[model samples]
Target: MGSNALINKHIDLKNKKILIYTGNSFGLNARRIMPSRPKTADGILRYAKYNIVGLVDSTCSEKNVSQVLPDLNPPNSPCDLKQAGKKIPIFKTIKDAKEKTSANVLIIGIAPKGGKMPKNFIDDLVWALENNFDLVSGMHTPLSLYPKIFKAAKQNSRKIWETRISPTELPIASCQAYKIKKPIVLTIGTDAAVGKLTTTYKLAKMANKKYNTCIIPTGQTSIMIEGWGISVDKCEGDFMAGAVEKMILEKEKEENPDIYFIEGQGSLSHPAFSTTAIALIHGACPTHLVLVHRPLRKRITGCLLLPVPDIKKVIELAEKTVIPSFLNTKVVAISLNTSGMTDQEAKKIIDEIKNKTGLPTTDQIRFPKDWTNLFMGTLEHANIRT
Candidate 1:
């Protein structure tokens, strides 16, 4: 989630302060029901160009963020570069974040269904624009589409960034992964928002300690963090895979990483996002995979009545679909999302997964060292060495 070494333009992120907006979703129950906002908040906290000063969640205002977000609690290290715990202040509105922290940017942290703006979220954006704060949105509805947001930005001399909108022109998919000699490993998931991006980042970080590696970010949050990546979900349906192919081929030419760790998005079983998921898998054409799952998850995040599928079925379906194109396509490791589970519960789930799948499994974000070791062993087994 750092800048690409090849990029020349640099933003002085350390000097800028950022405020995250979660609105009514910022409590224990909200963590499960509204995982996208909390996950986005944690990702920025772990790896962002700017400093995170406060979070806007009306329900949790005046409370310490460390107590609400499970990832920031004890036993799990902070994501800031300094590696120190900073008690982030929670505010009720964008105006509060502006007045208290003097934040320069407001990140639209929630990943809602259809990427639609929340009921009262526009009010917060209007207030931020009136105060001259730059707006960063990762939603399907671009801020430019709203006349009020557009006029406010022009009057305030502020910039509006819509990360989901793909570039106007993009190349077609060329199935380049088969032609390239370097190994490409993708981290996929059983359901959306189950720590696929986090696992990809952690794995790339670990691999870099011993091998030359780079990452392909597929989501809006990752694109912002990595400085360069194609937001596959935002692109036109036909061009999603090709845009991803172009990003990898271009990056490979510039950085020439020994291995490319492509970030995963959505799920094969997800009703709304399966098209993008398939496009990503085919575009990346990864030789091996790391399947991520959440043992406690009962249903798809957005669809309450849609029951979740078995982990085995998900893995089998993914592999069966890709075997014709990628002959050796197989899952090499497993990454579990065990946030809020007791130690014994987490351990039992991990052990059960290992026994059932006959593969290495761990709560990678909670215990990075263990994940690093497991992944390194997997790479060795696959004969993908530096």
Candidate 2:
């Protein structure tokens, strides 16, 4: 008896390479049937999401078709399911459909298999094409999702041409397949206007001097991260979990270094910035923290508060009042995010943080003439690499 396939009626897949496989289409009551593979794009094609029948069984009536159809999913943002009820397309033999409709892209969704695809399926498909079908293609349905079907595309004389499709070299096909294992160096920074990104960048640069540095969210945004000297291939701050996980994975794959120093994004109190605190809690979350502060503080009333009033009080507030309660860290390192803060003001904050926390204070990176070069452009001691 003949049967039909149900698929999205839109999106054309005529005269194009098509691959249909088995899976969600598999009916417990039905036997596993192999779908046809076509070479080159031809014209109209029809397919069933079920048993991979060599020559589809089209005798099955519409009532019989409904019994084997897969139900629809509750639509999300992109797949507008609310307005239009889902259309589960049904087709008899793939060849019959090729003679009927115009579909160029066939992304089939199927079930699981133990190992190899059944034999003679390729030859049977080639013969079908002789009857006027296009590239006997495989349906890349959900069954082949991720690593399962990543290597599904088999090599036959026809597929060998592929018009020259090249493979990419990234390791993370699935999170489990990622290839990094050592601690990765991280860096973060913000813009000079608020000084959050600026302070973070300076710290990242300093940390790079001693360790194999790694940059996060890879780009020239005022907010940036760097490792050793090379910037990361990519970076993003908006998605905290994704950013942290990516950095962790990236670092785990590289060579283990003495340490990883991650720069923060913004001022802890500033609505837009909490960079230092963020890196400490998320990216690097170091045992130590280099709190970059400026003498000039903008009050709610828009006034500039100077000398930070009393350095001792600020120190006491940071250690006893902060850290253990806020960041929950021992407050091991202190660094200045140099600002219009006079040298004396800078020294005061540094000394206060040190005396109170008993942590060492680090230097700051001032804005150089060409800030662009400080970012996108590469930087080296010139003599060291040469």
Candidate 3:
């Protein structure tokens, strides 16, 4: 338990210096086309409380992380642009990374398509474990299951943190979340990987200033960022909702925050991940929902022929599907992922969506002030006391 040791406890990053293994997915093109693949690395680089010493990507070796992914240094970045450019170096391999920087932990930073560890990654993983560095991964394929990797870890006294493992004992969902009195805001998406986590995390950060806010991470990327969460996708179909409920109840007892922002997974309209979305809705029993959409994306991420429906229809689908079975969960706000659009284009679409849906809409990353005000305004309008 390297990173997973922080589960249900406060995170301690004093001694950990991370080296992110991004394989070949550490470039601007990957950020645009396959954002989800390098999401763990990007999230850690942007939001990790711990120190990220370097990155291991042969394709982008000798270049800094900021140079490879310039947009990572947003206006609100923790590190200044100039400092980040010189601080986090990228190396060609784990050995080079370790020799160059004091990174005692190696993180598998890509979530491949099928969740299986790529064959080419085995050698590097083994090398890292054999050395002094511990291993941390959010991939569905558990590194502990591999005999060679497990043996190397045991022999070297290194830890293997598999972030995607579900809890051993999970109670089946009995609509227990409905009993909680505090507002539970769930971020639902129009399609998979459409800024749901980013929206939830940013909103929680803003809300924490005025209210006691907690983020219930439902996916691996959020778990890596937040340090305590259950990856519901790794759970059995029947236990997915149960796992979510367990985390909510546990966090409620521990922190008792005024607001809990549950990071969403998948989409109700996407055939591949519809079940996870439905399970999250029924499990969290959210009082308010924030619908996240990528305005320019015509089709679902992996589906070529499946066209994304209109924003109005997506809102209608979410409300209709969740209201009848559970609490009166309304889609209170709209969070647009305006990644590839210019500011003018993003603003135009934001206004159009706001007019159409009659909801507070903005890109949280591009316009932090507007999003903060809009989110707080939406909460006040909904009578959710901050």
Model 2 TM-score is 0.33
124-197: candidate 3 lDDT, tens digit per residue: 88888778777877878778767777667767767777788888888898778888877889999999888887
The true-structure Cα RMSD of candidate 2 reads: 22.2
* Deviation (Å) of 307 in candidate 3: 0.6
Model 3 misplaced regions, further than 4 Å: 1-14, 68-75, 78-86, 323-326, 384-386
lDDT of each: 0.76, 0.32, 0.80
Question: Model 2: which ten-residue window has the lowest total lDDT?
Answer: 36-45
Error of 1 at 54 (Å): 1.9
Model 1: which ten-residue window has the lowest total lDDT? 1-10
Residue-wise lDDT of candidate 2 within 1-386, one digit each (tens)? 01221111122222243333222233323322321111000001111112121213333333222233321222211112221123334455555545544332233222122123334234434433334332322222211222212223221112111111111222221222122322222322221123333334444444455556543432122110111121111223333423444455555467444334443443334333344334234433333333444434434112234223343343343344232243343333344454446667666765675576564553334322223242212222211100
- Arrange candidates by lDDT, descending: 3, 1, 2
TM-score of each: 0.90, 0.33, 0.91
Q: How accurate is candidate 1 locally (lDDT)?
A: 0.76
Better of 2 and 3 by lDDT: 3
After superposition, candidate 2 runs with Cα above 4 Å error: 1-210, 217-239, 254-257, 272-280, 283-285, 300-328, 344-349, 366-386
Candidate 1 — which pairs collide?
A: 46-79
